[model samples]
Target: MGKILVIADQKDSAIATGRGLELAARLGYSVDVYAFVYAPLGRLKQTAAERNALKQRLLEDREAEVQARIDKLSREGQKVKLKVVWQKDVAPWVVGHCGKTAYEMVVKTGRRSESIANTSTDWQLLRECPAPVLIVAKKKWRRTQPVMAALDLSSRIAAKKQLNATILSQAIALAEAMDEQLHIICAVEVPTLLEDLDLIDSRSYVAEAKQAMAPHIKALARQFDLPLKAFVVKRGPVEKVITSQAASMRAQMVVMGTVGRKGVRAKLIGNTAERVLGQLKTDVLALKP
Candidate 1:
């Protein structure tokens, strides 16, 4: 297959890079590790020549550091490439780079402290990156834990329906490669106005929702050969249900979809999946359509 792009954060957690290496080894894909470093000019109170010299020194130092880290993670028979760049805005740079190059996936570590809004680099990458983005958490995967795929089954839109398929396929591939089980989860959200107007009981609404989704779930089962025990249907806010199910099941990763667009709609994952990411402690594989 194609190569995987591993973005190394300034913090150098190694979690993202290490995960990328592991996936590359398993999937037989080459890896391109990019370490970003930037030095603010305002912070340096020196002559122009001195500032330039110091900046060059900083770049050399960071390159050496990142090289050493990659050398430690290197393995025999693995095709790995490394690049060190002085880019302050990593997300946009990556988006531009990926637009030019083809990669199977973009792997990066996520910050749990980011807000639910689409403001962080991770959120931007999820919305704009051409390739699938895998946001890794600090927690390591356990052998028995499964990879969860969260689907928006209620959406009648064709794009969303196709996105559900994409999410499932990616999750299945990852689960198989990792030798882990695959679990499917879908949340049915009831309109608040129905409850406010007393038009329908919450239980009734949820029951109806599940009934409507049964055929789609069955179709998925037939297409993917998923067992009944592998499915989980819950009624609640999408983000809450996903986070709860992932935690309860001790999932190693939660695969979900994000709509890649511009303007207001670009905030697709921010509305639901972004919230889930904010609360979830497990790794996430975000697909785009």
Candidate 2:
């Protein structure tokens, strides 16, 4: 596996750096922190000297946080590095940098608020990040338990499948590294309209989905040579199915992909992958294609 790149916000909560460092230590992977500094509003309208001072201060603050996090990781036997980047569009810049770097995974903290109106930096990072990204929220990080990889069988997007496979691969690798179990779950959504029409014979659909997923799951299991379990759920909404299953299985982390759809297309039709990210309490590893 390549190095893990953490795109950290200098102004947001320090949880981003803390989570990244913790994961790096647990997984035995080196960490490269890209600390981003947004241009100050006053500096945007200030004199050259004043703007320069503001920029210097921002850099200094960011550097201090980065160094502190790096030291913490070092105490845990992790090799850590820091890079300070001054960019207005930190999301795209981080994505482009990850594309060029030898990084297999990217970690960042989740948006502060879940309300739709309150769009945080982590939300933007989730939407645009290229690598398989982990959004750490305010909770105890589960490091030594099974990681859940949630698979949505409804969407037939090719990119989504590829991204899901990437997440599964990462989870399996992490589980192996940590000597933990890995669970692969495909959440099957039974349409309410079908239920209303008394056509909700979900067994066939569940069986078919399980059959289709069998080869992939077996191949992964064989590749990893680890204990793997697969589950096909045929009830409730995608988010509920995933969360309930993960909770039942006592999973430490949930890994899945983000389907890049928006507006009415995202709402009326909806994307289970995105909804699962929003609803789940487990640490999520969301991949963007």
Candidate 3:
């Protein structure tokens, strides 16, 4: 495991910090907590005394809270380092710094609702950040439960195999570290036109897909020397199918890879992995390739 950076803001720092520490402890990784503060330049243009006073107060407040969180984690047997950054562009700063650093993953909490036209900094980080992002929603995180790795077998990109494998491996390692179960899932979406034309038998297609995925699943099981739970193959919107399977299986976390496609094409066409992140009720360990 590499360094895990926890990105937080003034309002959500405590929860995010705590969650990051927990994850680092489970994964046996070094943890660093970062808080981004918006320090207005206009304020700096004010009287020297006023500017100094405001800067001093902000620094003192941020330091106290950060230290408290770090101390709490230390008491819990987690060694965490904290840093407070005064920056206007939180998302860009994270991306730039992470690109230069050796961090393998960035962990943060996700908001419930997002606007169609605008998104939160966390959302932006998911779309554009250089490092892999794990967004933990507000719920009881099951440290010792099954993790579902959702895959798209039909992706045109040949690189997907490597990306998917990394996702699955990480999920399995996490589960093993926590003494939990790991399940692999693939959503087989049959186009409505093909179904209507009867050109492809949906049931047969699903079966064939499952059969093809069997070899990979078995290989993983053999490598880990663990019994492989049944592989799931369903026909529907990939996002819905993945979420339903994870929920029905009572998975603790959904592991998957983001294709990194962007703009109107990605939005109009939609990617299964991205859509699942937006809709899943459980925490997501999203890898970028």
Candidate 4:
């Protein structure tokens, strides 16, 4: 029911619209995308006539992409609506808009370029965006590639607890739409404060954490109408456990929550979700709690 800000990367337009429109349809959210294009300084330094020619070329290119997308949607008989604003400096506007209006989530087509100095927008969004960010990879999802939803049962905030439910619900919707497997996982680690205590038993502690998580997991299962086996609680560093499980599951994407990078817990080691993003090759859907 809320707004969804989709920042299209324009890597593969068909793939972008396919993933974007699919998600919008699933959530029934009005899609507003800043269909961004990066023009190097050199390109803009040309003479007026040359720059006009370049502008024409860019316009034609964009029109072709839009037409192709329209054809695809027509063939598929999908009426998913999208409003696109062509923008150059993208990430700043996206972050700024989040403060202006509450966006439920942010969607994008591809990952940022590896070089931060050159292409840092998407990376910055991952760390700073107030809403959830869904970065869709180029490779279309396959039915066998599970959609992994990383759950943290230990977070006590009412907001975060509700966010876990939202993450799982969105993941379920994605899995159902794509007819893919849904893999739910939770990782447990001994609290650092408890290190001084002589009572630390990693296995027993992990077992108890899993036991404590059981009722919550079961409740999620009942709520989602999913089987208990779809959920798993494991022992390890949360980031490491998530990436490993996703790799083992051959996950196409991982859905997890964040509290932004400005929170106190985010200062010491950065958000675990960001670390997990670094380790994963699969697509990531980062939700905000």
Off by over 4 Å in 1: 42-53, 115-118, 139-144, 260-269
lDDT of 1 at 116: 34
Best-fitting candidate, scored by lDDT: 1
Worst 10 residues of 1 by lDDT: 262-271
lDDT of 4 by residue, 202-242 (tens): 67787888888889889889998999998888877899899
The residue pairs found clashing in candidate 4 are: none
Kindly list the per-residue Cα lDDT of model 3 for residues 1-289, writing each as its tens digit.
Answer: 5789997635545666766777788878888888766577564658878887887788778878778767865446566777887777777888888888977688877764555565566666777788888887666435436888877666647687677768877887878876777787877777779989999898888787777777766765686565765456677778888888877777778888886656666556655556776766677877787
Q: How accurate locally, in lDDT, is each candidate?
A: 0.84, 0.69, 0.73, 0.73
Could you tell me the lDDT of residue 10 within candidate 4? Answer: 65
Model 3 ranges with Cα > 4 A deviation: 41-45, 75-77, 140-144, 197-199, 223-230
Candidate topping TM-score:
1
- lDDT-best of 1 and 2: 1
Provide the lowest-lDDT 10-residue window in model 4: 74-83
The lDDT-based order of candidates, best leading, equals 1, 3, 4, 2
Model 1 lDDT per residue over 187-271, tens place: 9998889898999899989999999888888888888888866778998888889988988888988999876555555443345
Evaluated at residue 233, the lDDT of candidate 4 is: 81
